[model samples]
Each structure stands twice: as C-alpha cells, then as structure tokens.
Target chain A: MFKNVAVVGATGAVGQIVRRLLEERNFPAEKFRFLASARSAGTKLTFKGEEHTIEELTKDCFAGSDLVIASTPDDIAQEYLPSAVEAGCKVIDESGYWRMKEGVALVIPEVNPQDALDAKGIIASPNCSTTQMVLALKPLHDAAKVKRVIVSTYQATSGAGVQGTADLFDGSKAFLSGEKYEYKAFTHPIAFNCIPQIGGEKADGYTSEELKMLYETRKILGDDSILVNPTAVRVPVANCHSESITVETERPISPQEARELFEAFPGIQVIDDLPNSAYPLPSTCDGSDLVYIGRIRKDISNPNGLSFWCVSDNLRKGAATNAVQIGELLAKNL
Target chain B: MFKNVAVVGATGAVGQIVRRLLEERNFPAEKFRFLASARSAGTKLTFKGEEHTIEELTKDCFAGSDLVIASTPDDIAQEYLPSAVEAGCKVIDESGYWRMKEGVALVIPEVNPQDALDAKGIIASPNCSTTQMVLALKPLHDAAKVKRVIVSTYQATSGAGVQGTADLFDGSKAFLSGEKYEYKAFTHPIAFNCIPQIGGEKADGYTSEELKMLYETRKILGDDSILVNPTAVRVPVANCHSESITVETERPISPQEARELFEAFPGIQVIDDLPNSAYPLPSTCDGSDLVYIGRIRKDISNPNGLSFWCVSDNLRKGAATNAVQIGELLAKNL
Candidate 1:
C-alpha cells in the first residue's frame, strides 16, 4: 500500500479535518506533509496530539509524495494540478475545478469505487453538497434508476471556507448588537438570514453550485441523460448541508423498499421515523462521517416521484472524509 | 382608510411589524388596539415612540373595529375569528388557518387585489414564503401564463414564530461556544446547518410548509392545474425568505421580456445585473416591504423554463405588510 501522503491547503477548516481524519483512520502514512499558501506556511497544526508544521505549497510541492489530497480553492487547484501530475504522485482534488474535466475521474468511493481505479494520477471530489446528496441518491438510483431529480440545498457557511463561517458569526453579532454591518465573505449578512444564491450566477440563471450538481452527477453516475434541477442556497449553519430531494424513478418503488436500500448502504444512516420526532438532524451528525437521511416517502403529486430529506456534515462527507476515502481506495488499487 | 384597527397577537413578531407598518404607512389609524395572549396581556409595546398597552385578546377585542388583523397561531385564530367577524369588523388573517377554507379569499394585493372585494368579512393572507414568491411570479405569470411552477424556499426562522428565531440564536451560540446540543424550536440544530424538511412531513412526503406553498399559490393565482412542486426549508436567517423559482410558461418568453414584466410590477424590483453584484439581498431588504428579485434567465435545457431568484422580508411582504395591505383593501371595499 502507498504510504507517503501530502495534504495541500492543510491550514483551512477542510484541510484540518483532512489531516485529523487521516490520523483517526490510522492510514499507513510513511511521510506526512502539510502544505498551504505562503501566509499559512510555518504554522503548526496538531493532529492526534502531535504538532506538525505546515510548509508553503508550490508547483513542486507534490515531489517525494506518493499521494496528495488538495482541499484548496478552485483557482489554486486549476493552477497546481498539472504540477502534481507531472511529479508522478496520485492527486485527489476537493474543488469543483477538475470535477468536470475529461479523463479526471470524479470518485465518491461509497457509490463508485471502481471509477477510482481508472484515475490517471488525478481524481476529483465533487461539490460538498453534491457529495452527500449523491451518496444518499445512489442506493435509490441503483434500486429504481432515478430519471428526474429536483433538489434544493440548504448549505452551511463552512462550505465557503473559514472566512464564510467567521463572517456568519461576526455579522450575526453585529445584527444582535444593533451595529453597522460590513460585508466580507458573503454578499449579504448571513447571520439569521438566507442567501438564495450560493455560487456566482451564470448566464442561465443558475448559480455555479446548481450547475455543478447537474454536471457532476452526470459525470459521476456515468449518465448524462439524468435530468437534474437544483437550487442552491447558503444558510447560517456552520457544518451540515441538507437537501430536499424530489426524485422520479424509471420504476415505481415504494417508500419501504427505498428505506431498505438506504439502510443497506455502508455510509448511509436512515433516521426517517417521523411520528416519534425521529429524523436525521444537523447536530446529530455534526462530527460523524455518515450521511443522515430521513423523511422518505412517495411524492403523491407525480406518478413515480419520491421525496426524501438528507443531511450530512459538509466538511466531512462533502469534503475531507470523501478525500481521505479516495486516498484509501487509491492505496488498495495502486 | 383603515382608521380603527385591532391587531390580535400584537406582541408577536408579525403582529409587531403589522402595527409598525401601519404607522409608517400612515394608514389613517385613528385608534389602534393591541391584543395578545393572556400570558402577555398588560405588556407595553412602543410604536413610533408611543407606548401602547396590550390587552388580553378576548372575543370582544374586535368590537367597533373597522379592520381586525389576526396574527395569532392557527388554533388561536380558529378560536377567535368568529368573534372578530361577529363584531362587524372586516378581518384579515395573517395565518394560513382560513386561507384555503371554502369561502375565505386568499389575497395578495399586487396579484389579486380584486379577491379582497369578494371577501365576506375575512381576507386571508397567503403563507409568508408563498406570498413573496407569488408576488414576484405574478407579473411573469400574467404575461406568460405559467403552466407549472417548481419552487424551493429558503425560509427564515421568524416564519415559525418569535420562539423559533430565538432558538436559532440561542442554539447557534451554544454550538459555537462548544456546548452540548438540544433542539427545541426545530428537530435539527439549525445554528450551523440546514434542515430539508420544515413544518413536519405529510403522508405524501411533502412537508406541511411545502403543501402550503403548493396549495396557497394555486388559490391566490386562481389556478389549480399549475403543478407546483415545493420543498420548503427553514434556514438560520431571522426574517427573510428566499426562493429559487422555475416557471414553465405556456409559451416561450425571453429573459429580457421576463425582466421587463418583473420590473413593471408595483412591489417587485429587478436586480439582475450579476456582474455588478446588484441582486436582491435579504440583509438589504430586512425592513423593506418590496420583494427584491434578480438572477432572471431562461433555462437552457428547457425551452419553456424561466428561472429567477427572489428575496423579501418574510415578516413584511410574507406576513405583516400583506396582512396590512389586505386591511387597506378591505377598507376601500367596505
């Protein structure tokens, strides 16, 4: 198994989690390196109670590393990915930049582990909201073959990075204290508010996040014909992204059958009993790796539609955990 | 001119806003009576710097009132609506309790001002999120004749009640300060996350909030086969609700034409200049009565699909301003 691993952008929230999860999973690490921008370089991060200094990342940062996991911005990934591949190290990207690129495998290990084996030294992780959603949808898709997907995402601030999460806190404090507001990370003050647009709006009235859901799902599932309509919004939450998914399948599957398939998935936990106030919640899955799902039933208005509620810690299944899982798959295969 | 008005549940968020908006708009309120639950009776609320004592909302609270605005919970409204009606007062309901009842006219002034004249003493306000969305969609619907609507709402906590907004603040504070979590206002920790299912799940997997959007929109728009698929979500925002709306019109309408229609509407503002960052933002519209709209464009994949983003203060256009607007309509009709 490959052992030497380097984490690019290791100083940010997602990068921190990637480092922590690596240690927690006891992945065989021969040489561990933490990489970040120049400002974050020389900073020490404690993993499993051991302190490791972060190094400045450059085009040649991936040298001497068997595997590199990048949890950085899209611009940075687009800039440095070629260098990592040239260095002969396998790379797993956590940004949306490489997700749609041809021949760059988009891998969600729980759903499509086989795709990881075809990676030409670079694998792409999907948008955090898309990751948790597809994980929950895969089981249903396997059972009934989802034909149409209409999803509305309630995303957390952490999905935007540390600055976004911090802005929520600062902006909220400003609102509560009755002070002048300042906008930084978000277009509006997100404390006790919702922004309907998550990513920048494209020409077609869809935000980039919405388009990412459409394109990434098609690429990951290996089917372009799957109809997807997504509306992505940023909520004040810090960690979890929840989706209200309305799906139509090729074949009619009862809610009971869908529930059985979800319960059988390795990374999925069905918390759908509503009578006793049982359903997946953000707090319940805050630090966990599983996608918490509930509220599964038939969409009565449509012939074969099914509606379900899904929640997952965006920083985990949406980012770090999925990246780490990809590394594990790479180790097993290569 | 509504010179005499009684506000039931006057101490609640919506009730308070209704009172202030009446004063701000100078609605010729010669006398105003504030009514609240027995627990909150005798409390004082200041409007335009004048202190008004809240009275216990007995059945006789609406006596001699020209207009009575009911902003209480569904059960409270059901218990007291008859009293308001028997007192010879024209009633405007903020809650959805009477909205879809056999003869109660659901009215949005911009969309269905004529529906107000048909009211038999009671004019019902549409649900908050539904009201804002329909207000934004109405002009477009009239010009293009919308055949189907798919909406996913990013609703604020204030839509639930005062306690709901408070719970978000308290819970977010708790989680941020590293305390154990508990959920009182919502089934999930909404401080740093999003919950897909709001207002509980119905037997058909659609949430109660979702159903309200579907049914209320059809009723207000005077169309039943409009085919609305709604998924309502509760976000951490305090007072504004945002919606991503996709409308399939009977015929194709260009994005430019759609923008012209939205801008021509009395209460709708078009903020579609994406490059300049000029879009409807919740924080900016926190105290405004207008429904701010932006991100308008055609759905590339669907020839007839037109998509847009809409935001409004749920407390205003969604609830209070709508109720007060209905009160204005009632007085004109009376």
Candidate 2:
C-alpha cells in the first residue's frame, strides 16, 4: 500500500506506547516520522530497527504522510488536525476534541471497525474511559440491546498521561518518607487517595471525562437512544482503568448469556470465577491490551438489568493500543 | 442511670476503635469490660483513665453487662451473639450475620435511631458500604423519595479488619522494595489494585458483600420497594470507604436542593464546591463519624436522578462509632 505514517505527540507517554506498539504489532508503515512539541522535538526514538528524530509538531509536518495518528491533548489536536487533513493526511486522533463533531467517527476497532473505514478525514478514538466501556458494552448491546448504562469508573492516574503516572510514584515516596507533597498532575493528592473529577465541568455538571463516556458510547456504538449515566473518579493506581457497570437491557440477559457474549467478542478476555477467587483487577490487568471482564451477575433491582466489572490498561487498550489497532484497520484498505 | 458496658473482640481492629470511641465520645459507661477470643483474653485496653482486662468470651461473659458491642467477623458473632442477648444484654452488632435477620433492627442511629430503641434483644449495624450509602440517600430520599439507587463503592482495606490493613502496608512496601509480595487480605494484590468481590459468592452470582448493600439499604431505609443495585469494590486504601452513587427519585432533585438537604441532615457535611476541587476523599475524611459528601449533581439520563460522591471512616461511622451511637440511643430509652 506504500502508506507513510506520522505520529504527532510522539514523545508523550501515549506516544512512546504508540512507537513501541508500531514495532511490536509490526504495523505496515512503509515510511515513519515522529512529531512532538518544541521541547520534545529533536529527541530520538527508534522504530523498525531505524532511529527517527522527533520533529516539532507544526502545520507542515504532515506533508508526505498518508496516515497521522494524533495523541496530543484536545487543544493541540484541534489546532494542528485541520492542517494534517488539509495536507491530505487521514488522522486517527487520541483526543476528545473532534469526537462528537459532525461526520468524524469515534471508533473502537474491535467494536466498530467499519466506522473507521467509512470516515472521510479524521477518525476520533474514544476517551480512555470510553474505550474500555464501549468495548464491554458492544457485545452485550448486540444481543439484548442496551437500554441504559449506570457506570462508575475507578480510573487510573495514567489516563492523565506521563505526569499523572509520575506523580503517583513521587507522591507515594514523599508520603512514605514523611515529607509533604501536593500532586500537580491531579487536582488533589493521588498517592493514597481518590479524586472525583477528571476534567472541568461540562453541561449538566458532569465532568468532561464523564460526558465523553456518554457521548462517545452513542457515537461509536451507533446507538443514540442508549442512556448513559457515568461517574468518573480517579484512583491512585498507575495503569489500568476499572469500571463497575450496571446495564439495563430491553430484554432479560442473564449472567451466563452476558459472559458468553463477552467471551465471543474480540479484544475482551473473561476472567470470571468467583469461588476460586478469580476476577478482574486493575493491578493484574496492567500491560494488557485486552479489556478484562468479570463479576458478572444480575442486578437485583431490575429484572432485565446486568452488572459486571471491567478493567483495561489505560495506556494500552484505552489509548495507544486501540489507536494502533485503528491504524491497522485503516492501513489494510489504504 | 449507671451503665455496665462490655466490648467484644476487643483486640481486633474494629474492637480497638469501639473502645477508643467509647472514651473519646464520653459514652456514659460507668463500668467497662473488654472481651475477646481466648487468645486475646488477658490483653488490656484503657478507657476513661482506667485499664480493663480483656475477658475471654463465653456463655457467661454478658451476665453483668447492661449493653454489649460486638465487632467481630460473621462466624464469631454468630457463634456467641445469641448467648449475649439471652444473658440479658442489649447488643449492638457490627457483623453481617445478624443484619438481615428477622426483627434484628439494622440500625444507623443518625438515619434511624428509633429503630434501635425498638429492638427486642439486639440491634445490627449495617455493612460499612451500606452505612455510608444510606446516610447519603436518607436526606435525598426524604425530600424527593429515592426510588432506585445505583451505587459503586471504593471501600478501604481496613474494612477487612487488621489483616486486611496489614497486607496493604506489607504489599506496598514489598512492591516498592522490589520484593515479591502476595496479598492475603484481598483475593488479588492490594498494593495497586481494586478487587471487585468483597465476600464470597452468594445467590444469583452476586458476592455476599454486594448483596449486603442491597438488602441493608432497604432495611435501614425501611423501604423494600426501592430498587437498589450496587457494585462493591475494595481499593488499596488503609481507612475510610467512599461511594459513587446515582439515585433516581420520584421527583427531580436539583443539585442545589440536594446540597441543602444533605447539609440539613445530621451526620452529613456537604463538601461540594467543584470549582475549588472540593469533594470527598478517603484520606481527608478519616477519624470522623460523619459521612462526607460532594460532587452533587443531577443525572443526565433521568430527570429525577441525582448523583454524588460520599466517604466515611469505615472504622468509625461504618462500625465502632455507629455501634456506639446505637448504644447511646438504647441507653436513653432504657
């Protein structure tokens, strides 16, 4: 296909993962270029047995690239994305900026690869919180049709990027050594505590992260009628994000059916066996691209309601891995 | 009006707090006795400037006591609680064994103190997860009548008692020091994880800990018609439990009105200033009997649905302090 690939924000935490995954997955990029901010530019990252310099991410960086995987913040994605598209580059963005915008596909390759194939310019990847959620919801909704989702996320600090994961270690060391530390990566201390807000407030008092789950789920799942109520809280963990989800289906879906549906789904591994003490935990699920699902049961409150717990490495399946998977799907047809 | 009070399982984590709260809250105990299993019988604990020997718990241990506070595991409480009540002692139990038993008042004194006074022999304190949840639900349920509740808990390891807390410290130190650590306090490693299952599996694939939240909330709120769905998770924390709650009321409850209701209710302090990053965290709410709530907002899915975050010291409001409050209530009626 002779596809030339460029990665923006290629020196960030997610960018490093993308760089590693490109070689690990043997991504079909004939030519590769890395771009980051001015501070990270001129740094070296190796890909496919060749060293590549991280160029400054500017308007002109995407001139020869056929596909650009953007892992920058939302504002940066918005600022430079149009230029990438104008330069004839198809962007798979890892930001919340263009997710809900008109005509842009919010894609999870495992759940909806077809959406990515149909996108015209930029295909937006779901948020880290949203990616793992919709992946779990996809199989369940396919069979019984999900009516409502009441989810509470036990998200990790790594979702905040490199600084968030670094602060977790630094804050813990400061506390364990009896010195004082205030976490700058998060709004509150993240060493041994939980914070309730992920981003600034949005409409209806939901944080931007919470709203991303609601909106992105509908867009990626292609079901706007599905009602979602999400509470996203940041825990002290460094990697995998966990969610306790209660879903109401249009028809009854038992625990057995839910388990079977999840097991059959791609990018999902079921680790559910209660008696022998087997279930999903964020710590154990770290470093995996697959979202782990367990604690499958029926919600006692509603007859058609099902409850389950899911975990995924926020850096892998939540962001870089999924972004790479989308690039794979896009590259095949290029 | 002299009160002869006895505390059972006195050497355990919750039992130690029960002893301290008794003195710190100046519970009008004229003569105090400490009792535990035979291994801890001779150990001594101080109360009100007096040292008391721990007596071995037996059929005859409660003979001279007016009130007994039980803070043991389910099996231990089951083995000896009936004997304590039969021996003419009014007992406030902190174990899950008697919570849903017929006619055993599952009491949270701040929410339903009158239920304590109506007890025939023993009053059961709700589960730590249920304790913090109902406290937040009561005020909103009072003003708008909560019809359906969806709660996810970020419970602390201390809720597992001494061994659970010790494992958190041991596991973290082992991880930091690069030594292999196996966590016995939880089913998985508690160093940097979240375990979804608390107790063993029960009916319909739900864990015993999760069912406790469903059943206890109904009993404490005195409304079995209200639908409750809960996912109980144990986080890598030492003390205090937190909950992310989504409540559906009969009528819409605005964020402002919900805040005022929580503030007006006793044993609840509203800390919901989002602009300044004000919300409940397990770290800050330690050592208090009050349930701290914040992140109060209306749910986007349902007009009548309200969402909030709550935290409480599991040892205090969740167990010892709540049990003591019930004792104080029982004493006044006597």
Candidate 3:
C-alpha cells in the first residue's frame, strides 16, 4: 500500500521542508531514507515519529526507492539525480537543474497538471519566486492570456538558505555595534537594507533570479512567447516572498472580472479592498500554504495592463507544499 | 552679520535633521527660535553650544524673524506658513503643501539653483524621495532629454519619521514571538516585509509618494512633457532609500556617457562594476550626502531606454542637506 521514498540533501532548508510536508500530509511510504553528502551524513533526524540517520548521498542511495525528492543544490541535484532515474526511481526535483531539460516536466500542479504525466521519471518544481508568481498569474492569465509581465520582487532572506537568515541577524548586530560584517551567504549585508541584485548577475544585466522567472514561467506555462521582465530584490523578510507585478494582457478585463477570476482559483485568495485596508500582507501570510493575491486593479498607464501585489510562504507553497502536491499527483496519475 | 531664524515643528525627525544641518554648516543666524505647538512649548533643545527654549507657535512667532523653515505636517505647514509670510518672514517650507504651489519654487539647490530665485517668499523643498531622484536624473536630463520614467523604490523606515522606525523594531520583536503586532506608523508589520503602498492611497491607484515623484520631477526639471510612473515600497531598511529607475530618453546615450555625466555632477558617485560586485549598497551610503548611483546600463527592451540604481541617505541628501544647501543659496543670492 506504501511506496518506498528517499530524500536527497536531507539537511537543507528545502529538504527539511520537504520532509515536513511529507509527514504532515501522511504520505504513505514503506521506507524512508535521508541522504546527504558524506560530511552531513550520520545525523539523526526525526521524521513521522521515527528517528533515522542520514546516509551518504552516493549513487546507491536511490537503489530501491520508488520515489526520490531531491531538494539539494542545483549542481548536486543535476549530477546525482540521473542515477536515481537509472535505478527506476521517479524524482520530484526542487532544483532548477532539470527544469529546462528536454523531457522533464516543469510542473506547478495547480497550474499545469497534465504535463505531470509526460514526466520522464522526473518533475521539476519552479523557483520559489516563480512558483508564487505563476500561481498568482495563472488565475489572471486564464481570464486573459498575459502578454508581458513586469515584476519587481521583495524576497526574503531565507531564499538564500539557512545561513542567509543567520547573516541577516548577525549582520544587523555587527552593523549596530559599529563593527564590520564579513559577508558569508549573501554578496552584501542583508539586515537594515535591501539588495536590488539577487542571484548571480547575468551579462545582460538581469539577475539569475530575474531570468529564472522569465525562463521558468515560459517553460511551466508552455508558452515561450510570453514576455517577462523581472527585478528580484532581497529584503529582510524571513519567510514570505512578495511581488509587485504589472501585467499586460491579450484583452482588456475589468477589476471586478479580475477579482472574480482570482477568487475562483484553488490556491488564490483575493484581498483587494483598499478602503478597509484589507490587502494581503506578508506578516499575515506567514506559514500559509495558499498563494495570497491582492491589490488588484487596472494599470491606468496602459490600455490592457493590470497591477497587483502577491504573497506566499516561500518555504511552503514555493518549496515543500508544491513538492508534496507533485508527489500527490504522482501517486494518483503516475 | 547673521539673520534671525525660526524652525517650525522643531521636535520632529526632519525638523531635528534640519537643526543639525544648520549647526553642522554653521548657518549664519544671530538669533534662533525653536517653535512648536502649545503642548510642546517650554521644552529646551541645545544647538551649536546654545540652548534654545521651544516657543508656542502663534500668529506673531514669525515677527522679527528673517527666515523660517517649516518642517511641520502638510496641513499645518499650509495653514500656518501663510501667516508667517504675512508677518514678514521669508519661509523655506519642507512640506508638500506648498511644494507644487503655482508661484512657490521647489528647490534642490545642486540641480536647480535658478528655480530658487523664483520663490515668492515661500521656497518649498521637494519631497525627500523626489529630492534624491531629480538630483540623479537632472544630470542625465540635461545631457539627454528624458521623456519617460518608471521607478520602483526600496525605501527605508526613516522616510515615515521617527515613530515609523520605532514601529519597525517593535513590530519585528512581536513578529518573531508570534504575537499580534501593533501597527502604529504603517498599516502592516514593517519588520521583515515590504509594503507597496506609501504615503496614503490616491484616487488613481498611485500612492501620494508616487504622484509626488511624477509632479515634482516635472516641476524641478521645468518640463511638463515628461511622463513619470512610480511604485513606492517601504522595505525593511533603516536609513537610505534605493530606486530602480528606467528612463526613456529622447536620444540614445551610451552607459559610459551617462556614467561620465553622473561623475561630473556634484554630490553623486558612480559605482557601476558588475564583474566585481561593486555597486552602491545602503551600508556604503548610510552616513553620506552623496547620491550613490550605480548599475548604469542600456535597457535592452525599449528603444532609447536607460536603467540604473540610485541610492541616497534619505535623512541627509533627501531632507536636511538639501534644505541646508537651499539656505546657503538663499544666503548667497537673495
């Protein structure tokens, strides 16, 4: 009745989140293996009331596992996950390594479910920022095909991994006490400031995070023609990732129609009323699985343009919850 | 050898900064009067080694004063400052109430000194955000006429005044402990998140801060034909404000030429170097008066578009320093 499961990079933020989602959803697994690098191995992690030791993430770690969730860094996920496929294990990859692959399906289950079927032993989860953007955009995109997306993100420190969160707290202390901050996780200080450049800088002046929104959205939506311009920024927020998005649609739609469409979506919440101050705030959306959408209105500058604010728990909907949903889809459809 | 000076709202954030600037620059004032409301009268403050007793601001407070700097709230500045003008004091108002007035000149001394002379006894300082923006844009607008501007700001807590900064700290503590945050200065928690709306919402969906950028740029640049659209966000930063500005110019200008123009301008430092990660950060410009400009590049999307990042100490260059510079110009010329 249960499938054998394995988790790669079991010690990471995303990996721990993946484990939490699996436990919370009561995903039936015959056996669970926690795999990490040799250096990270042998640590005891409690999952679903059982304490299991982390094993070295060698090629053999995926030998008998029916499903493998790789929440590791991109390079390791890319290099090692193909071995899992060779061992006949399906992979729900939470890294961008396999996202643009020729055969692998880049899936956001709510947005694109049918593509999950054509998965050649692997499914790619979109970037944390992209996942939330698409979730917010899909409802509106369905009402009217989004032609161009101009987005500016106020992302959290956690997206840079656990050490990034620590850097914010530590850096702020160092700054307040008149001491120099030795940068570790981020390229600069994360506390008491906002960094406009996120991810590595591209030669074309777009950051890697910005390009991921463009590339991942195109791949997931199955629409390469859609234009996306993104500027990802690292704010001091801890969990939720917020975006100020302006979209140009193929046809004009009123704010009422837009609100209706958003409210109709499964994982979207419409919080657009300004008079009552009932807009979505990240502080309110912390730990929530649903993608919170608000500030819906027509962009007065352009004929068919719409502007809105979007927020979601990056660790949940953006990472673990999405991966778990992919597993649920795999359990039913695969 | 010195003029008698009066400071309205002498206990507020901008008021404190203006006082510090006056002392730092050794502003030539033989007599100084600190004026506040009836409730705040009798409070004493020290400036330039002299203690000044705060006086209740009444109809006659402006009498015998040569120059009065009004840093009060908008409605108060509007209603009270006209009385100051009637009482024969030449006023430099730092409130938005008189900034866009028909005859009142919005002055940022480094960029538009000639505009200051046109003031009809009430010289209005530009909005703090607008002050830094036009300072960076003027050098570019001079070389190439800017037709349009699209900016997204990562503003700081200081922009909302002292209470705003306190709210951020208190809200952050409440947020981490899982308690209901008391929203004082903002409608939501400002600890780890960004708010897309700043300065109250306007009729057309743009915030008051956004509209100020639009109108003030047109006034300061002396060009009503310029089209400006801005989205202002209050990020979790403490001191400086950063803006991602995209400009559409009438003519094409290379990134290098734009860099040279900015470098030649006073109170601007160009820090564009992508390969080495040497761009302006708020920490780098925290205590400085310079408008730190970086990441100057050509916009690949539009036909004569240029993109750059502008960072400045909102309290200094954006408020106090600019006011002091205007006072210097008034002293020299008027």
Candidate 4:
C-alpha cells in the first residue's frame, strides 16, 4: 500500500466527489492529504469523520506523498504534476493537459487497465464526454472492429464545473421570472436552450471538446485507425451527460447481439425498453458510476451501423469515480 | 387570387402562427374564414385587424372556400382532408396523416415547389424537424448526390403543442421550488432534461418521428434511395428546434463549397463563425422563418461526408409558415 495519498484540487467539484468516493470505497491508503490552489487553501473540509484543512498546492508539495490524484484545471496539472512524478509519486491526473502528451497513458480502468499498470509518468483520465463514449465503444470494438463513429452529445451543466450548475439553476429561475441574467460560465444562456459549441474552436471547424472525443478515443482504445465525427453540444440538464451515438463496424451487430455484448461488458448497464418508455435518461442516470446504454437499434442508414443512446453522470463515471477507480487499480497492482 | 380562403385549426399553436403569417405576408385572398374543432368554434380571433369568429370545422364547411390550409392533428386531417379534396378546394395540410399518402405531395417550397404545383390532391407540408433538415440538405444534395444521412434532433417542447410548452414552464417552476409536478405532454420530465423518444414507437425500434425524417426526406426530395438514420430528442427550449446532421454524399463537398451552396439556397442562412461563437442557437433562431446553418465542417470519419448544425423555428418554418407558403404557390399558379 502507498504510504501517503494526496488529493489535489480538493475543494473543486470533481475533487469533492473524489474525496467522497475515496472515503466511501474505503480506499487503501496509509495517510491522506488534501491540497488546492492558494485561493481555496485553509478551507476546512471533512474527509473521513475528521476535519482537515486544504493545503495550498505548489511545485514542491508532492515530496512525501507516494500517490497523487489530481483534479485541477489544465495549467495547474501542467505545472504541478511533473513535480509529483519527479518526486517519485505515482501521479494520476484528471485534467486535459497531460492526456495527449507522448508517453503519458490515458487510462479507463475497464477499457485499458494495463496501460495504467505499466505507466511511468502521470496517468491521465479523459474528458468527461470521451470517457463515457470510450467505455461504451470498448466492448463493441473488441467484438467487431469499430470503423467509424458519429456522435452528438447532450452534455449537462455540471460538466462545466460547480459554477456551471449554479449558472443553470440561477439563470433558469431568472428566465422563468422574466428577468435578464448575466451568465458567467457560458457565453450564451443555457437555460431552456441549447449551445452547439462546447470548447473553443480547434482545427477543421471542430471545437476543442469535439476534437478530444476523436483523439482521446484513439489513445484509450489504442487504435489510431478508428475515425470519429463528433458534435458536442451543451444542454440544460444539471448533472449527467447524454450522447446519441451511431457506429459503423467491420460487421453488422444486430440489436440483440449488441444488447448481449453490452450486458456482458464491465462498467455498462443496458436499459433499453422502448414500448414502456424506458431508456437511459440524464435524470435517471445521475449520481451513478456506470455508463448506461439504451435505445440500442440498427442504424437504418448504413448496413453495418448500430445506433444507441448513452448516459452517465459526468462527475462520477466520467470524472471522480474514474480517477478513484484508477487509484484502486494501481493499489491492487502494488 | 382565390375568392375565398378557409384557415382550419385556427386556435391552436401552429394555427395561430399560420394566421399571423398569412396577415404578415399579405396573402392574396379575397375573403378569409377561420375554422376549429367544436370546443374552440365560438372563439373570437382577429385577422388583419378584424375580429372573426371561428366556425366549427366540418365536412360541409368547404362549400364557398376555393382554398383550404389546415394545421390539425392526424385523425382530424385523416377524416376531413378528403372532403376538401372532393369539394374541389385546393387543399394544403400541415398534418402528418396525408403527408405520405399515395396521392398527396409532401412539399417544402424551397426544396420542392414544383411538387406543390403539381399535386392533384392535398398538398402536404413536411414535419417541422424534417422541413429544416431537408432544406439544408437540398443545397448539398443538388451539388453532390446525398447517399446517406445521420441526424440527431434537439426538438423544442412547442413541437408537442401548447401543452408541451406549458409542462416545460410549469414543471421547471415546480422543480426549482422542490415540488413534485406531473408532466402532461411527455412521459418523463422535460424541465432541464431530454427525452430521446419524441413520438410513439414504430417498427424496428424507431419512433414515428424518427421514421418521418427518413420517409419524409425520401418523399420531399423525390428520391427513395437516400438512406437516413435519425434520433429525435426533446429538449427544454420553448420555441426552436435544433439538429446535428451529417451527410455522406456521392462526392466530397468541402466546407467552403457547402457554405457557398447554403448561402445561395433560398430559406437557408449560414452563421458559422466559431471564433466569435456565432453559430445558430435556439435562443437566437427562435422567431426566424429561415433555416439557420452553422458549424459546417468536414465529417472526419468519411471523405465524402459533411456535417453541420441546423436551427429553425419549429412553429414557423416547420409548420405554419411552410403551409402558408404552399398556399401562396398554388394561388400564383391559379
């Protein structure tokens, strides 16, 4: 077991969830440390039936901790994570910064745990949207080679962090009362509306978030040949992210076969009953750590294509739960 | 000009818009009559600044009217539209019943005006979701033959009728107040949530609304070979419908060429400036009559595939406006 485990960005949204999950799962660790930025430092937070003050994060803060799990913004991860690795700590990052860097493993424990077990540097979790989709595609790609994917995401406000959910609730109240609200988290009003663009523009007219869905899927699945066309949009839902996904494979996977494949896979639950109005919904799937699949059917457009709806709590399976699961996998290997 | 024109279903959501559009466009009709179901028959509505009492819709109501434009439910259209045809009235319907009927011509004026002009019986307007997508696809398909389409819709509650919007508002209010509210129009809560299924279940696990995107596109474009895969979802927006559409064509249509084609196509406006976050949004496209296209980019999965984001007022271009435009076309041909 690790002598000490440090949780970075402990006061942030995903960080808070990570703290809870570590406690709930009774994670194997000798000592726990909570760290955050200077602005959030000195804040008192309860971790495991005891009060702990959040320590200010710095480049030299990782010397004693043998394991570091961070959930900070990109710049913070970029600046501080390398210090942890140099300090001889097993670092797992939950930021967008280090995932695509050469020699850094992007790990989804269910999809590719061996990469995490073999990593020498900071291990990275994927973007929230990419994590859920890659987990769903893992079983399919293993059974029948997934050639191409067309995905349109209905992402929730919480994916934007704590301020995003705040904006959604506050802006919604103002909209219902006919008052103008100045949004802080999004450029446009997300209450009772949809925003087609998620992250800032990247190359080829795709947003940075859309491109991540493509690049991250390739990295995690270790198949650079898989092509992904993604359109990421923000919806008003407060928690879970949902996607309408269509995949074309080397061979046709019937709905019946797809259902069995999903059920047999780890970290996925199939909830597809159309006659009774059953499917994976954001409200129903919120707070869960499993990727939920529903509306599984044949894509009538292509002979080898299959279409389905996927939903997962962006904070849990998509972020905090995923990071904690990675910590558990590493601990088990040790 | 037609001597007499009758507006059926003149009190509901789309009906009100049809009334306003006719007045706003200064339709060339010598006389106007408003008709509705028995529940709304005695209601008073103003047309061109004059108060008109709604007459009860019946088979005998078409005696003097030379033209009829209808926006009613399927059963009403299924029962009454044939009567108007038999009464020698040039009928235009905005219901789903007659749209796919053998003798009826499903029309989108910008895409298939000639179909409206050539119809011997009831000329039908396509579904709102189908209308905007077909219009956007028309320009691309003309330049390169569209072989397949995969569309995911973010439909507004207004498409569910007045009750749907009410449920959204009231349910949102209740949800914000932490109160339990029963939904009226949808099986699940649509307040800040998405329901993947729009219409009732049809064959092959596709909803009726999803199949319409497939069947309606084939009929309106006069091409039965074009394949479509659609996932229709209802969002919390109050007015417009948004769609994420990807099309694979016979040849590659570059983003620049697609933009030029969309700019030249009537009823389509391009708003794709991602750097400034200027894509078409439901909040911005709520009242517009034209279909708005944005986020035009290459489908990285297929060399021949192109993707775009589309938004339009479901009540206007999707229903009332299309029906009124069809009436104007037939009036001119007279």
Best-fitting candidate, measured by lDDT? 4
TM (B chain), model 4: 0.99
Query: On a 0 to 100 scale, what is the lDDT of residue A43 in model 2?
Result: 81
Docking class of 1: acceptable
B146-206 per-residue lDDT for model 3 (tens digits): 8877777889998898988888777766655578777789987788877877877776667
DockQ of each: 0.46, 0.73, 0.47, 0.89
- Residue range B1-334, candidate 2, lDDT tens digits: 3378888988889988988888787887688888999998887767777787889998877888988999988999999999988988898899888989898999998799888877897799998889989999998888889898888999898988888988987887787778998777676788777888888888777778888888898899999898888888888778989999999999999999998899989899989877778888888999888999998988878788899999999999999889998888877777
Q: What is the lDDT of residue B150 in candidate 4?
A: 96
lDDT of 4: 0.95
Better of 1 and 4 by DockQ: 4
> How accurate locally is residue A240 in candidate 2, as Cα lDDT from 0 to 100?
94
Model 4: colliding residue pairs: none
Candidate 1 interface RMSD to the true structure: 2.5
Q: Candidate 2 residues A284-303, lDDT tens each? A: 88888899999899988889
List candidate 1 segments past 4 Å from native.
A37-63, A180-183, B1-4, B28-56, B60-63, B178-184
Question: Clashes in model 2: which pairs?
Answer: none
True contacts kept of each: 0.50, 0.65, 0.36, 0.84
Identify the candidate with maximal TM-score. Answer: 4
